[model samples]
Target: MAVTTAPDRAATPVRAPAHRVRRRPTAWIFAGPAAALFALFFAYPLGASLLQSFTAEDAGSTRWVGLDQYRRMIDDPVFLKSLVNTGAILIVQVPVMIGLALVLAVLLNQSWLRFRGTWRALYFLPAVTTLVAYAVVFQVLLKTDGGLVNQMLGGVGIGEIDWLNSPTWARISLILSLTWRWTGYNTVILLAGLQAIGKEQYEAAAIDGAGTLSTYARVILPQLRPIVLFCVITSTIGTLQLFDENYVLTKGGPDDATLTPVLYLYRIGFQQFDFGYAAAIAWVVVLLIAAVSALQYLAFGRERRR
Candidate 1:
C-alpha cells in the first residue's frame, strides 16, 4: 500500500510567501491619469449631455421635461428639413464617393502606375486641408460674379450660377465640396485594403480567362466589401455630422437648404440659448449614428455570409 503523507506543520512555522501585489500595477499606474482625464473630459460630458437632453431651461434654471424635447423634434419643420437634407446627402453622396474611391483604389494598385505615393498624397491632401479655409476657398471659387467657377463657365459660354444662394445649388455645392475633400481619403483606405490581397488572386482570375472588369466585379470587389462598408459607414456619419463646410460656405444657406443636424444643434444651443433642445438634437443624432452603423454592420455580415 502506498502511503500518502502531508508535511507536518508542528515541526516549524510555515512562512507564507509575502503576498506582494503583482508588478503589473505599473501599467495601471501609467494608465490612471489617462483614465482620469477621459472620465473628466469625454465620459463626464457625454453623461452630462444625455442628462441635459432630458431637461429644459427657463429663467436660467434647468427643469426636467423627460421626452418632451424629443417629441418636439417630430413637429419641428426645420429639424425635419435638416434630417431630409442629411438623408439626401447620405443617399446621393456616399455611394458616388465610394464608387469613385474604388476606381481610384484599383488604379492606384496597378503595377503600371508611376509615382503612386505622389498620387496618393495629392488625393489625400484635400482631406487634411484646413477645413474652414478650404470652405472659404470654395466660397470664393463659387461666387456668382467674378468667381473662378463663373469665369470658367463664361469662357465656355455658360451663365453664372448662384451656387450658394439657391437651395438646390447650395446642396449640390456642399455635396461637391464633400466629395472633393473625402474621395481621396477613401481611395487611400481602399487602396490599402486592395494591397492586402495577394497578387495570386489576380493571376488566377486572369488565368481563368476573366476580363479585368469581370474579375473585379465578380471577385476582387467582393473581397473588398468590408473596407467598402467601413468607408460607407464613415461617410454616412460624416454626412450626418456635416457642419463646417456648409457653415462656412453658406451658414446653413440662403433658405436653410444646407442645414445639418449639427448646425441645427449649434443654432439651438448657442444662437437660441435652448441648450436642452440642442442636447436632445445631439442625442438624437447619436442614436441615429448608432442605429445606422448597426444596420450597415448587420447587412455587411449577412452579405459576407453569402
Candidate 2:
C-alpha cells in the first residue's frame, strides 16, 4: 500500500537478447552435425567425381583431359549399346509397371475387399526380398533346360524359350524381373496417393451418376497426376542406373544386350580400372536423368496450368 508496485515498475529488466543468444547456439548445435555429414559424404564425393571426370590417369600420372572421355563415350559402341538397352527398359518397363501398379492400387483401395492387408503384404513381399536372392531364384527358374518356367511352357505346347542366352530373351528376362520386383513398390506409393484423395469427391461423382471408369478418369487420375509423375521419374532414373539384376542374373551377357549404364560404368571403373572414364559416364547419366526429370516436370506443369 506504500506505493510498492509503482516503485518496481521502472526497474523491470529485458531478457530477450540473452534468450536469443541462447537459442542461436542451440539451433546450430542441432543442425551442425547433419550439415557436416552432408558435406563430408555427399558433397565431397560428388565434387571429387566431377573433378575426376575432367582428368585422366595414365601410367601412374594424372593429367587434365577436359572432354576427351566424353568424346570417347560417344564413339564407344558398348556405351551406345548400354545406353540403348537402358532406354529400352525405361520406355517399356516403366509404363507397364506404372499401369499394373495403378490397377493393383485401385483394386486394393476398395474398402469392401477381403483380406486387404494380407493381399498388400503378399504383393509387397518381393520389394523387400534380398536382391541377390531374387536374382538367383529367377536365374534358376528361367534356366533354358529343365527349369520350372520352361517345364510349364512345355506342358502348354510352347517350345522351350532361352531366357538367359539370347539377347531378346535376356532383355525380356530383365524386364520381367524388374517388373516383378518394383511393381508392388510403386503400387504402395500409388495406394498412398489414392488414400490421400478425399472420399467426398467419390461421393460427388456417384451422385452425378458417374461410373467407376468415369470417376477415375475425371477425378482420381487428375488428382494422382503428381504422384504418377514422381513414380515415372524415379522409375526412369532407376532403369537408367540398372545394374544389380544385370550383374546377378545375366551378367550383362548375350553380347551385352542387357548391359546398363551403371554396369558399363562398373566395368570401366573396376574391371578395366578406368576411373576417369567411369566418372565421365556417371556424369553423363546424371545429365540424362536430369533432362528427363525436367521434361516430365515441365509437361506436368503445363497440364496443371491448362
Candidate 3:
C-alpha cells in the first residue's frame, strides 16, 4: 500500500518567472523622472566642470585651452595659500568636530538621560538653522566692539579680541563656526548608530562584570566603526571644500588666512570670471577628496580587521 511506481511519481510544476508576476516596465516608468533629474543636475554639472577645466575664454568668451589653466594653478600663490588653509581645516577641525559629535551622541543616547527629546532638539537646532542666518548672526556676535562675545569676555576681565580681524584668530573663528554648525548633525548620526546596537549584547556585557567604560570601549565602539568612518570621511570632504562660512563671515579676509579652496574657486570663476582656472581648482578639489576618502577607507578597514 505504501510503495508507488516510479512512473506514477511526478515532478513539481514549474513556477512562473519572477518578472511575469511583477511588471518591471512600470517600476522604470516611476524611476525615469528621478534618473533624468540626477543626470541633468548632478552628472551634467560634474562632466561640464571637468570639460570646462580645459576650456579657455577670450574676454568672457570660452574656448578650449588644453591643460593651460591647470598649469597656471601650479604656480598661483593664492591657490597655494588656499590649499594650506583647506589642509589645515581638514587636519584640525575634522577630528575635533567628529570627536565632539561622538561624545555628544553617547551622552544623548544614554538610557538614563532625562528629557532626551528636548535635548536632542536643542542640539539639532543648529543643524536645521539656515546657514545664511547663522553666518550673519555669528558675524554680529563676533564683532570686536560691543559684540556679545567681547561683552562676555569683558565680564571675565579679558580684553576684547579681534576675532575676525586677526589672521590666526579668524581661522580659529571659522573652525569654531564650522564645528558648531556640523557637530549636531554628526551627533544625530552616531546616536542612531548607538540606538541600533543590540540591547541584549550591552546587558550581557554588564552581567559579565563589564563596567560602563569597558562596555563602551569593547562592545559599543567596535559596533560603531562603520558609522564613525562615514562621519570622518564626510566631515573631511566637507571641511576640505569649506566655503559658505568663510565667504559670508570673513569673505576669505584677514590677509587670506581663512580662504578655503572653494572660496578661492568662487573668486576665480565668478568674481574674476576665470572659468578655466576655477574648473581646474574644482578638479584638484575632487582629486584631493578622492585621495583622502581612499586613505580613510584603508585606515578604517585595517582598524576594523584588527
For all predictions, the C-alpha RMSD in Å is 3.7, 4.0, 3.4
Report the CA-based lDDT of candidate 3 relative to the real structure.
Answer: 0.91
What would the per-residue lDDT of candidate 2 be over residues 1-306, giving only the tens digit for each residue? 575444575578756887788899899999999999999999999999999999999899999999999999989999999999988888899999999999999999999999999999999999999888999999999999999999999999999999999999999999999999999999999999999999999999999999999999999999999999999999988888788898998999899999988999999999999999999999999999999999989999999999
**Backbone Cα, N, C clashes tallied per candidate:** 0, 0, 1
Q: In model 1, which regions exceed 4 Å deviation?
A: 1-20
Arrange candidates, best TM-score first.
1, 2, 3
Candidate 1 vs candidate 3: the TM-score winner is: 1
How do the residues 215-264 of candidate 1 rate in per-residue lDDT, one tens digit apiece?
A: 99998989899999999999988888999999999999778889999999
List of clashing residue pairs for candidate 1: none
lDDT of each: 0.93, 0.94, 0.91
Best by TM-score: 1
Please give, for residues 1-306, the per-residue lDDT of candidate 3 as tens digits: 698667533576677898866877888889999999999999999999899999988977888889998899889999999999888877889899989999999999887999999999899889998888898888999999888999999999999999999998898889889899999999999999999998999889989999999999999999999999999999998888888899889999899999988999999989998888898999999999999899999999998888
Badly placed stretches (over 4 Å) of model 2 are 1-16
What TM-score does candidate 3 get on C-alpha atoms? 0.89
How do all models score by TM-score? 0.93, 0.92, 0.89
